[model samples]
Each structure stands twice: as C-alpha cells, then as structure tokens.
Target chain A: MNEWLLIFFMAAVTYLPRYLPFALAGKIRLPQTLERALDYVPIAVLTAIIAQASMIRQGELDFSLTNYHALAALAAFLVAIIWRNLLLTIVVGLVCFTALRLLV
Target chain B: MRSPLFMMGRCFPETYLMNYRTRQFWLGALETLPLILAAFPFGIVFGALANSNGLTFAITAGMSSMVFAGASQFIAITLLANGTALPVIVLTVFIINLRQMLYSANLMHHVAHWPRFVRAVLAFWLTDETFATVSDRINRHPEEPGLRWFYLGSALFMYSFWLFSTILGYTLGSQIPGLSDWGLDVAMIVALVGIVTPALKLRADWACAAVAFISSLLTFDWPQQSGLLFSSILAICVGMLLSRSGKTNE
Candidate 1:
C-alpha cells in the first residue's frame, strides 16, 4: 500500500469514533450502564498501552532482567506516585532508563 | 429527545453570564502547560523514532497533524517498520484510539448543546491531555459558560506544541545523530503515568488497570498487536462487571 494512502486511512479510522459520539451527543442519551462502562475506558486503555510498550517486544513477552523498558517503567511509576508531577516523573524515568541501559 | 436546555442538569446551573472566554482560555492553556511540556520529549522522541523507522519527513509529520495521537502513531510506525500490512496497521491504530470514544462521551453532556462544527473541531482536538485538563476544569466549574473556549485553549496548545516539536525533532534527528537511541520514548510512558495515577481514586479504576496490565502481559504475543485490543476489551468488561455487581462506585 502507498504510504500516503495508509496514513489517510489511519487518520479516517482514528477520527470516526472520536467524532461520532460527540456528533450524536445531544441526539441520544446513553444508558446508565453504558455510561458507567465508558468511565473505565481511560484507565483500561492507558494501562494496556503501557503494558504493551514496557513488557512486549517484537511480538513476544520479555519480562526478563534485560527488559530495560519494564524496569524503567517501574521506576517511572514509582516516581509518578512519589512526586505526583508529570515532568519530574519523565525526567526521572529518562535518566533512570538511560542509566539502566548503560548498566544492562 | 427532550431539549437538554430544559433539563435540570447535574452540572451546576449558569449562575453568572460573565463574558470571560479569553480569561478561561488562557487559564485552561496555562493549567495544561505542564502536560504540554511533559508531552514535548515524547513528541521529539516520536519524530526521531519515526524517521529512524524509514518514514519520510512528510509522512512522519503528517501523521502528527492528521492522526494527532501519540501512542497510536508510535504503534503505527513500529508496525510499518515491521512490514505489517496496511489494513492491520489501520485497524490497530483505530483500536488503540478507541479510548477517545470515552473522552467524547464524557464531554458529550457538557458540550451537547454546541453547534455541529464546533463539536467537530473540539472532538478532533480531544486527547488524553486535553481530556484530563478539560475534564478537571468542567468538574470544578460545571456552570462556567466559557468551558468550551477553555477546552479549545488547552487542546490547541498541546496540538501546536506536538506539531512543532515533531518537526523540530525530525529536522534535527539526522544532523544530530543518535537522537533516536537516547531512550527518550520512556518519557511518554512517564507522562502517561502522571496523567493516569490521579484517576485511580476508585476501586473499579484500579481493578480495570490491573486487569489490563496482566492481560497485556499474557496476550502480548498476539499477531499484529491485536493483544492490545483484547486486553482493553477484557479490562473494560472487568470494570463493567465490577460496576454492575455494585462492588465499586460507578
């Protein structure tokens, strides 16, 4: 597939769900159950993405010691809890991950 | 459908018709400045990664402009680099971004009365950062009429920062050398941690996250990253079941 076409397709698929709900926002009131379910999406999705990025590599699981991403993500998660600041957590994670990379 | 205008909404009533759109805009932008800064390193890293992955500067930056999603864009570039098929790549990104539907739904009640064009623009601008920032603002000042402008302010600021930084990183990545190898992608994860930690106030929220994490680990080997889709679905189902059983707050 042409790269441009792929990107366009990506943009379209990405845009539809985002726009559909808002476009129909006033037209339909969501059921109570569905609304509650929607509330959990952010946490679920964020955790899933983070896990995939940290724990997966090349379509396989890599939870061994050499998996620097999982280690760094653990460090970053700790920093996020302690400092509760986004910038500090990123800075600490970058430094910790890079340092760990050098050691491993 | 009854006009929501007549409903005694849970959101605070518009008490004062104060014309403070500009103030609210600046406030929203200022409040989200930290997140924008947090997202900066990720933007740089994404550009560098995309370039190193064989994406042209045009397509690399175009993805930023059109898709406007960091994680999904990163996933798409990685899949493309691995010679993943276009259909698979598109489907993967779409699934990755499905969470945005929640953001859209969350804000629907607040912005339902908005015009179609305005809602369209705002919907396009919705992202994790903007959703967090704007949702915080609306929760605090539910009665504020300037909420829409405030949302625009934050979203546009983050959007512009992402675009400019991606370009900056892309242009410098070649000349600077080793930029992609610097492990800056970790910054995105850290920033996400920062954003998601506060939302773990409810037991169901924590349960949802835990299920997703464990499920992602177990399903990591699924082809074309479909494991991500499965994990998300599983997590949502866990969350919904918990909520349904009345074991956790709704």
Candidate 2:
C-alpha cells in the first residue's frame, strides 16, 4: 500500500514539472530570473549525479587514484569531448572500466 | 534520385514542404535511435536492481511507465533498498525531476501553438533524450512545419523502447541469480557522462558543472543522498549569479 502510494506521488511530482508548463503555455510567462535559474538546472543536476556516482566509494568520498569509476568517467568525458560521439564514448568507457577493474 | 523538395529538406528551410511532416517524424526517430540503444542496458539494469531491491516486477515496470525518468527511478529504487521512508523517497525523486521544468520551459515557445491534447501528450512523453532530440531540432529549424510530429516520434520511440526493455530486464533478473550484482550499472554512468560532457561547451555550463561536482563531493556524507540535491541547488544558484554578473554566456 505504501509503495503504491509512493509511486503515485512520484508520478504526480514528475508529471507536473513536465505537463504544467505545456498545459499553461500561453496563459503564463515565467519570470526572467526564474527562467535563468531554470536554465542551469539540467547541467547542475547531471553534474551532481555524475560526481556522486563516480567519486563516492561505499558511502564515503574516495578521491584517490584507485576510484575506477572516477577514472573511467574522466576518460569517457575526454572521449566525449574529443569525438563528440555517444557510441564511441560508451564503448571506450565500458572497455576502460572493465580493464581498470581487472588491473587495479 | 531524390526530388529537389526532398533535398531542400536537408537544409534549414523555414517551412517544411507539405508532405515533409511524415518525413521529419521518421527523421526524428532515426536521429534518436542511437540514444535509445544506449539506454537499453540501463533499463535492464534498473529492472534487475529493482528486483533485488524488493520491488515486485509489476511495481518496477509500473514505475518505469509512470515515473518515466531513468535517473530518478534509480535513485528511488536505491532509497527503497535502503529502507528509507516513503516520504523521503518521494521528495528526493521529485527534486531530482525538477530539472524537467527547465526542459519544459525551453520547449514552451515551440510547442505553444500545439493543441491542449498534443501538449499534454508531449509533456507526458518528455525525457532527457526526447528533450535533447526535440530541442536540437527546434533550435536548428524553428519554423519546420511538422515539428510536433517529430517530437512525438522521438518520444514514442524512446518510451516504448524503455518500457519493453524494463520488462525484459525484470524477466532476466528473476531467472538469473545475482544479476544486479554484476556491476552492469556502470553503463548508466557512462551514458550520463556522454549526455553531460557535450553540454559543457559554454563557460556558464562549465561553471555549473564544476560547482555541482565539488559540492556533491563535499556533501557526500549527507543522509539519504540528499547531498546530490544540495549540490544541484547550490550549483544552480552559482550559475545564476555568474549569469547575472555577465561573466559567462554563449
């Protein structure tokens, strides 16, 4: 019961951010300041997720050279920047992480 | 072999030819096909993880269709695995999804002319992949006649692909022991990096990314992974300040 409720709540929470603006498109104009803040949301959110997922080890901050995820992510970042190809980046990242896992 | 009108579609024409809506719709799906494939692993992994995390297959697939955001769904599943309270999970997932408002805002101008039902469907279908795909199209070809259809094509393709893949992953998880422990979730991080790195082209974008990265690291010990939320909000404020000071803009 509780889990289903949570799912429904989540559905509502996620939907409003997406559906409301489109539903209210011509009726309401967002403030300029708010618009500017919203612009940074995606990049900021992605960075936080990537940083936490890669840099943290077993619930602690692991900044050392042995953090395989961090290293693989760094390599993937560079590949993405240079090649600007998603497939190539994913391929390089998976291979790099697997090798680093074995060697490290 | 193609006619001049078809060739002209490749250019940045203000309006698509009368019959080009269907073409653009297919084109949009084709453009997003690679992204859809990249997401397959994550969808499967999400299912496996959800299974290990104690969610029924029904709930897992249900959440995939209802919540419809991969990253937030993962976060929720992890929180559930940790035995976190329901309210906490809901709030965290909600905050994580607040970024969709930015996506919706960016797309508002292009979709304003669409009907209410169209807007509702498109909004429900919105995801990072669809938003990225559709936003790129809108930016490049603002006046394209069949833009809505193109957005729908990309959204539908990603939506159905994700739903079916989640089911497949759930089935595999039940059959294979310790499937979630295989560390296949690393592909998700790789896909996310692929998404974020390309957007780091502008100075403001880099500033936001840097602040978010550092703050998340600093707050890594926060309970319930609230650190991510803190870091994201802090980074948004910093980015806003930087934009206000006129130091970074593209």
Judged by TM-score, which candidate is best? Answer: 2
lDDT of 1 by residue, B27-140 (tens): 677767777886787888888888777788999888999989987888888888999889989988887777787678877788888999999888888888898788766655
Q: Chain B, candidate 2: TM?
A: 0.77
Question: TM-scores, in order shown?
Answer: 0.81, 0.82
Q: On a 0 to 1 DockQ scale, where is model 2?
A: 0.63
Expressed as tens digits, the lDDT of each residue in A1-104 for candidate 1 is 39889889988988887899999988999998777777677788778878887777655788788877778788878877776666667777778888888775
DockQ of all models, two decimals each: 0.55, 0.63
In candidate 2 chain B, where is summed lDDT lowest over 10 consecutive residues? B1-10
Over 4 Å off, model 1: A57-60, A64-68, A98-104, B1-19, B50-56, B78-88, B138-145, B244-250
Model 2's CAPRI class? medium
Retained native contacts per candidate, as fractions?
Answer: 0.75, 0.79
Docking class of 1: medium
The best candidate by lDDT is 2
